[model samples]
Target: MSDAGKLRIDKWLWFARVVKTRSAAAALCEDGSVRLNGSRVDQAHKAVRIGDVVTVALTGRIKVLKVVSLAERRGPFSEAQHLYEDLSPEPPRFEPPSPVAEREAGSGRPTKSERRDLDRLRRPDD
Candidate 1:
């Protein structure tokens, strides 16, 4: 790529395979979930440079990554992984799974009429 050709932040994130799609990256940018140099960036068109720190807030967790290289196009996993380095010192700890609700005993699968009744309950009066 030429010196003038630089990867956009959102495009880089997508090319890096950080998020599933380009739209997701744009959404993250619009939502202020993605930041550059400790400040939120509004436009996804911003150019990304090597060594720039990127913070991504995703699904109730935050991930920090450092841009290591620029990619103009989406590539294979090996190539994508080289684009950035995860700098989070620690992994997000797992929370214990919630307890399942106890079901009443002898509550066997409903019959055809019972199924209809359940479906009726789901519908609003009209």
Candidate 2:
């Protein structure tokens, strides 16, 4: 493709608001946390064109985006959103375990209240 038809991956990431800063995007690319069309991207200057799939690994989740358009400058979220079509899958739901006090009957040791009641019952008349 011609030069005009492509843009550097780092620039595109920043322009699309996928990352907070261009330097972060470059660091992500250098860290091999970015993938272009399923291939690892180790350089910030790699060229990306419309219709390419870009996968980015973030702290707790991964983002999959398809290039829909290119941008010339960083813009507002509404404008940036148009630059890519999000294809990321839904993140897994997390359900915290029930509290220890809510455990099933006879599952574990008695609670403090239970122990207090027991002690009261065991005490002689006084």
- State the local distance difference test value for candidate 2: 0.90
- Against the reference, the lDDT scores of all candidates come to 0.82, 0.90
How do the residues 49-89 of candidate 1 rate in per-residue lDDT, one tens digit apiece?
Answer: 88789999888668899988887678999888888899866
Positional deviation of 22 in candidate 1, in angstroms?
Answer: 0.9
- List, residue by residue over 16-49, the lDDT tens digit for candidate 2: 9989999999999999999999999999999999
Off by over 4 Å in 1: 1-5, 95-126
Mark the 10 consecutive residues where model 1 has the least summed lDDT: 95-104
Q: What TM value does model 2 have?
A: 0.75
What are the clashing pairs of model 1?
A: none
